[model samples]
Target: MMEATTQAEVTAYWNARAPAFDGVASHVAQGGVWRDVLAAAFGAGGPRDVVDLGSGTGACALIAASLGHRVRGYDGSEGMLAVARAAAEAAGLSVSFDAAVIDQAAIEPASADIVTLRNVLWTLEQPMVALAQAHAALRPGGMVLVSDGLWSVAPQFRSTYDPALAARLPWHGGLTEADARRMLAETGFGDARSWQHLFASPPYPGDVPMFVLSARKA
Candidate 1:
């Protein structure tokens, strides 16, 4: 298990990356396949109450809102929240953003139709705890989308050329598709399944596939 203080570093790292993270949102918006995939998992209907955890720069939350879902984006980093808020305003989308950690977000039980956690698990110090919170925040039939990939499992490109680079990198082990499914099942989720799509921005290697682990509250 990771120590609690590690969260501080995580928050700081994200704060620094907050501005650049909007490129991810832009990429997702511009990409047809990814948008279609998200719509299928999240439903095409509008006005669903969606809660997005670790919502950096409103990537998922803002997009959901744009599609007419009632979205709330919660993040621990104030820097990210600020950017998200501005983006929401600029887009004329009514996305509510709050500064809160995933595990401890002040969401009510059975209050949301959907929950999203994109690329957040690997950085978490208490992933199980955060998943439990997600389970609690959802309505009985609500679905949660866990979007992640084998980022750390990919070759250390920088380290391949420099011997000392590997030690400096933050190597939090990533989950396999099976690992993601098992986790949702173990955390009281039902009907867990998987979907995948490639994102265009940040330019991950073609071999490193991005996956979406969709599960419903039982």
Candidate 2:
């Protein structure tokens, strides 16, 4: 099938929408539960470096920074990085921005205490490859945090449909909750545990349905 993901198209899509993404993003999320979920995953603070994948606008990175962890948010979109960098500066936070896909570079193996894949796993044509890379990048005791959901099969993506936004995404994939845990466990993430919370935003079903996941590497 059309390579489920088109990186160039997805990058362009995020680039154009980067500036305004954060403003509208929160409303779409479930009261920002993922932040708290991440906090719980890695604990408050310690010696840890977190790799936030597809970290558009650097929301998660900034949170980790605030909690006193070295944070790096990587994205292929320079525009998105620009926006994230600006926000980090405004918040007086220190988060390094890396400009590349996870698989494109040689990440320091076993250097990270936590690997973050928020909302990114479902958008890749090579989720397993990316997961393996993330696994390799984590320290022995490190962890991988992933959060996305089952894609739209019912009525299949109707509302929340913004032409400007929709035009930006090249393609999308939906991951089952079971597989989220399976990938992490098989990739050598010791004691992989799945976290699922129904985020109902009082009304919009599509915008609120999401899950945040984390798996620890042995």
Candidate 3:
């Protein structure tokens, strides 16, 4: 299990990287690809309430807000939240960005229509706890959208974190679509589904395998 000290280390690591985080293609709002992908996953909806956990730089949160959804984004790194808030202001998008750990975010139960975890699960110390939090945050029939990749295969994965700390993360090596689906189901979600075509031609290098998983609250 991840200790409180290790969690603080993880947050510090992310805070150090927050400034240049958006330089990565996948971390920013990619013209139409991300917008379209989120729209499809969110389904036909009108101004739904969205809670974005691990909302680094507010990419997905901003996109969701732009699509008319009311979005609240939470991240453990204060530096990241600063960047996200600045981005939201620049985009004229009304998104509330707060500092909070993924698994311990202070959100009201069943208050959200959608919860998003984009490329965040693999880095989490307790991904199952985060999923449970997502489950509790969503209203009945609400959706949780998760996007991540087989980051272990990427050449730079080893350099992204401290070797010792990385070794402790449950999914630091990465996870598959099947793993995500199973986790969602185990967390009391139903109608779980996955998609891969959205990342068939990744914008970044390494050709890391990516997937998008969406499931409804049971």
Candidate 4:
């Protein structure tokens, strides 16, 4: 289990990479994992009260809102949250953005029908704790979705990222499919499953996997 990430480091890292991250997002929406991730997460469900954790720039949150899900986005980075707010406004959608860590977030328990933790599991210092918090935030029979997969093959990882990006990459908690499911289950989630699409072969982006870990409060 990883310890809590310092706010300063996380802020500095994201602050420095904000522009690069935004550029990547635009590119992803054009032809990449962004659409697939959003589709897999929201396309199958009806309108839901959704929370997009680590929702940088409101891509998923805005999309979900457009699909009629009342969405709230959470992130630890203020700079990122600013971008998300602007994006939401530009889309003419109303989404509540929370600038806080998962555990420290002010959201009450059993308030949301679905809680989204996209591309954040592997980046968190305390993934299990984050899942537990998400579980608590959702209503009975709510859902939690986690997505990640920057690298599928070992040698291929080197080709995708340079040293700085590689070093500061979202999180150190990257787990395989089995471990990911196990983490959710261990943290009080039921019916955990992972789905993935490997787009750029092994030497590029690897697999953009989706882990939808859902549970009904018993």
RMSD for all candidates, in order, please: 4.2, 4.4, 1.7, 4.4
Which pairs, if any, clash in model 2?
Answer: none
**Relative to the true structure, how large is the alpha-carbon lDDT of every model?**
0.75, 0.70, 0.85, 0.66
Give the top-scoring candidate (lDDT).
Answer: 3
TM-score of each: 0.84, 0.81, 0.94, 0.78
Model 3 clash tally, residue pairs: 0
Badly placed stretches (over 4 Å) of model 2 are 1-5, 27-32, 44-47, 153-171, 198-208
TM-score of 1: 0.84
Task: List, residue by residue over 1-218, the lDDT tens digit for candidate 1.
Answer: 33545666678777987787756443444545556667878865658999999998777887788778999889989998999899889989998898988877889889999999987876676678778988999999899999776765565521121223223323245567787787888899997776674343433443555578789997
Model 3, span 88-202: residue lDDT tens: 9999999999898976678999999999998888887889999999999999999999988788788573326788888778898778888998899899999777755764377
Q: Which tens-of-lDDT digit does each residue in 1-218 have in candidate 2?
A: 11324666667777888777866665236436655556677775575788888788887888778778898888878998998899899989999998887677458888788888876766565677788888888888788888766556432442223444444443244556677777777777766665554332422345535566777777
Clash list (residue pairs), candidate 1: none
Model 1 scores worst on lDDT over the 10 consecutive residues at: 157-166
Candidate 2, overall lDDT? 0.70
Better of 1 and 4 by lDDT: 1
Instruction: Compute the lDDT of residue 10 as modeled in candidate 4.
Output: 57
Off by over 4 Å in 3: 29-31, 157-159
- How many Å off is the CA of 117 in candidate 1? 0.4
